[model samples]
Target chain A: GAGVSQSPSNKVTEKGKDVELRCDPISGHTALYWYRQRLGQGLEFLIYFQGNSAPDKSGLPSDRFSAERTGESVSTLTIQRTQQEDSAVYLCASSFGTGGTYEQYFGPGTRLTVT
Target chain B: SQQGEEDPQALSIQEGENATMNCSYKTSINNLQWYRQNSGRGLVHLILIRSNEREKHSGRLRVTLDTSKKSSSLLITASRAADTASYFCATRSISGGSNYKLTFGKGTLLTVNP
Candidate 1:
């Protein structure tokens, strides 16, 4: 892909339902990240994957939030028993590598509305 | 907790004017980056300033970093209506061990009138 791509641009789910968000990173990119942003709020770091190793998982808000990546390719974020507070935009980004200076390219994001 | 916070939550300006936004962060950082978002969509990278560098420019965009004060500012010269969007600043922590994550600020919403 020429750019980072996210699936199901918009999602409306009921409370307690499970939702899965997907991300397809740019070709040959080695680093992937997931973030959450509430309305009128800054982005919240969720998880980061570099190649096949993730050294940081401290940002995941709760046990209900979990994510996984396969190789250096696609990644998925799963939210179990979603709550009304879960209504927000989920963004995914990828960089050439996990280095500190690499700039991340973001996806269109998935707007999840929990009713 | 947000590592960075942008000032002036919202600003409205006419086209051709300059738009400036500031970001302040706690703790040291290896670099700072600015991004823009339109209509709640994904963010687009604008510019980045490393800790060793004081200022950088790209096209109509100017970015300045003050590591000593732990603050940064982004200046968009001759702004256009197309520049109407939200601007955010993100910082890379200076802990120095695979710190690839970027912590973002609340962002400033800029509206440029025609």
Candidate 2:
């Protein structure tokens, strides 16, 4: 009965370094999503994965951002050559992939700070 | 490129008073959801209102949707100090497909003073 879980609750890295954030969705959840939240701003969609289909990459800010989900359980969002502007809280969410379920459980998130 | 917009960026009210937050979106949506975040950490799903349904109630929380106006409102009755947090409205486009991605608004910061 665990909710979504994200590792490395906080990360601080210098600009130009790469960082990987991990998320573990609840059991049986077939849909996973990543989002970024800047200070005092709204949640920005990043990517999504459903079952075995291709992930939705339209929301990735740039090529530096990428994500991969192994099967339907774990996902990792990677930032390559991070920039100072990349600082924000990275949030992960998952939901049941049934026809009309929209309630998503969220992880605590990884607060990434680029200096 | 945000689809939903919430009014009154911030609000302050005394405990036991009623609080209302409004949201407006630009596109047709399959459903609208409300979430609460404390200390900028994880978001807690509060309620979800489908496009067909106009109103819903969960405990002291009341949510109403008007597809004609592309708007929604969340009202909390007899609010407590514990209710202070950042509230956001997320919209799932009618054409969102299987991605299940939600477009969120800027959010409203509510401060309940006890």
Candidate 3:
């Protein structure tokens, strides 16, 4: 079976443009998460979607960042009016929701460069 | 806020030698997990230890958790050159409910020279 997959391995865009990054979680996974990693820094949590529960938006840095998952499969992280500070590698991860282990599988990630 | 903090930002060692990295975190957690990254791309999940677990072993990887001290350690035995990468410790906070959102540390970059 395939591991998590993210589209547009690399994306370059000018400031103020909107960009949508896609993620395809492994089949049967019901939990998905998004995180951002700046150069030489740790990963920062962005948002989480588990089954049909309301997405956890606590980690979203600002209103410009948002994410949506249809059912328990594909997810998209959208950045509205991106800023130069938004430049970083956006990583997606998925795992078994309930009654499963804690390990998570990750996607290759989308390196977004906001110039 | 960052929870887990890995000690010794970087390390270098010869192949076949053992390597050890430690992490200290704040607050109670449901579990601790280790991840490896190559070229700063997708992270590979190495191991996971629940809060109640004291130690675990997976192949050459060993992980120990000390809830009393709020710390954890990752030891890699007989390392290989291919093991050179950044290792990060992450914690799933008890306060995170079902979200299980992990708070990661800055990570320890290990260079294994063949």
Candidate 4:
């Protein structure tokens, strides 16, 4: 019974560079989501994936933010042309299904610092 | 724009004391969930109360949802120092088209002094 896990606990990159954050959801989870949290701020929804259907990219701030999930397992969030405003903690979460009644389990997150 | 807003922003209490946090949302929701975050790490799901339920309890945690008022409250009794953390309320809108998106509030910082 493993929980959600994210890679590169911390990442430091230069402006204009691209960074990819990885997330490994719990086994058997069919839904995954990505969110961003700025310092002392609330979480901002980024994207969501349910099974193999079309991913919800409505929350993506810009065209630079993209995410892909292979089947129902891992997901990778990529941010292109990073800016100072992009510096924040990228959190990943997953649940048994795609709606209410299921609680989403979160990952430790990857702190990205754009210098 | 966040769907939910937590009141009091911060709270400080002595160990064994009870703590209460309130959250107010603007839109209709199918359910409301409370989560605890230690420092800035990952969030831990504390409780989930459906819109139809007025009150629910889990150990020392009690959650109440009032759909008529579009608000909810989380009460933690006999709090310990380890209970100090940021509490957030997330709302799952009634619209099912959004899929798994849960709008979160800014959260309340709770400090339990032992």
Candidate 5:
């Protein structure tokens, strides 16, 4: 649509349950990113997808955190076997390029709470 | 790990006063960008300064970069209550393996009193 959009806006799950956060990036944008922000903290890079290049999975904090983006459109970040530490605002952003002066457009973000 | 660190941690100023926040990074960067967040939700892109450039302005916001010192500063002139939010500086590193990643700082919480 006009800008990056994220689903749910808020998610509350059990400590052991799994949660999936979705992001629909602005059309034609070749790069998308997932980040997490704890209360009073900064954005932490979770994963990045750029064009057809191999998705940068290096930022994933653990094996339980995974993301999938089909081509350049929608992306889903799944947190399996969630813990209290997973509670945070999950943000999604889209950009023309991660480099070369492209500024990221962010979504409203999904505030995930694991109880 | 976060590459940039914002100073002052938190800042409070009356409306119409100027608010300045500083950020320092550990490595070289291709560009430095400032973003604003309200109520802890989405972030709005403020301004960006490239490595080759030193300063940039967007409306009431101004940013300066010093590649030699690996530092940058954001200035919000004649601030308003609506301008009260968390400001962050994100850097696109120049490293070969991680040039695409934008590392962010903890942010400076700005509170503009009315």
Candidate 6:
């Protein structure tokens, strides 16, 4: 639609399984970011992609967490061998530019539950 | 690693009253932003104050940044029940590039009673 869109608003999976969350950013937006928020906790930055540049993956919690963005459009976050601690809401945001002044538009987020 | 820390993990205030939340961060920053989230949904950007700016106003929302103190405050005047939500401060480190990721605080949960 007009705003950022995320798939699988809610997902439940067994521990040790894998999960992939998707995000479709606003049309033409050049910057996309991924974050994770645990229950009663603030957001933790995961990764960021700007245009065709190599993504900044400094924030990924572990090697198990990986993400990719293609053509500055759709992005996916993959969590391998999920653990109970991975249960949280995964949020995606996009902005018009890589500048510090731009405001980010956020998606509804995907709530992942690892049982 | 987290960059900001908000004081008063939770707050309760009466409607029509004012509510204030404070955030402190480590290391130098290029800019700081505030966001609000309701019921674990998407976050809405409220206001942003650059390191060079001391204060900014938007409607009933006021934000202040003290670079020397490495802290910021968000004030909501004439609070309403609908204003009750979690407020978070996100900071962009000066060392990182302008497009660097934003590090967020634990957040302050505000409850406005009618």
In the range A1-115, model 3's lDDT, one tens digit per residue, is 9999999999999999999999999999998999999997789989888899999888899999989999998999999999999999999999886332468889999999999
Which of the predicted structures, 4 or 5, would earn the higher DockQ when compared with the native?
Answer: 5
Identify the candidate with maximal TM-score. 4
Which has the greatest DockQ? 1
Model 5 Cα lDDT, one tens digit per residue, A1-115: 5899999899999999999999999999999999999999999999999988899998898999999999989999999999999999999999987665888999999999999
Candidate order, DockQ descending: 1, 5, 4, 6, 2, 3
Let me know the TM-score candidate 6 reaches against the reference structure. Answer: 0.97
TM-score of chain B of each: 0.97, 0.97, 0.96, 0.98, 0.97, 0.96
* Candidates in order: C-alpha RMSD to true structure: 1.0, 1.1, 1.4, 0.8, 1.0, 1.2
**Fnat for each model:** 0.86, 0.65, 0.61, 0.73, 0.80, 0.76
Judged by whole-model lDDT over C-alpha atoms, candidate 2 comes out at: 0.93
lDDT of 5 by residue, B1-114 (tens): 999999989999999999999999998898999999999999999888899999999999889999889999999999999999999999998888888788999999999999
Q: Give the range where candidate 2 chain A is weakest over 10 consecutive residues by summed lDDT.
A: A96-105
Q: How much native contact recovery, as a fraction, does model 1 achieve?
A: 0.86
TM-score of each: 0.97, 0.97, 0.96, 0.98, 0.97, 0.97
Off by over 4 Å in 6: B96-99
Could you tell me the C-alpha RMSD of candidate 3 in Å? 1.4
CAPRI verdict (incorrect, acceptable, medium, high) for model 3: medium
Lowest summed lDDT across 10 adjacent residues in model 4 chain A is found at A94-103
Where's the lowest-lDDT run of ten residues in candidate 4 chain B?
A: B92-101
Tell me the TM-score of model 3: 0.96
Worst 10 residues of 5 chain A by lDDT: A95-104
Per-model DockQ against the true two-chain complex = 0.89, 0.69, 0.64, 0.80, 0.82, 0.77
- Quick one: how many clashes does candidate 5 have? 0
TM-score of chain A of 4: 0.98
Q: Pull out the clashing pairs in model 1.
A: none
* Interface RMSD list for the candidates: 0.7, 1.6, 2.0, 1.0, 1.0, 1.1
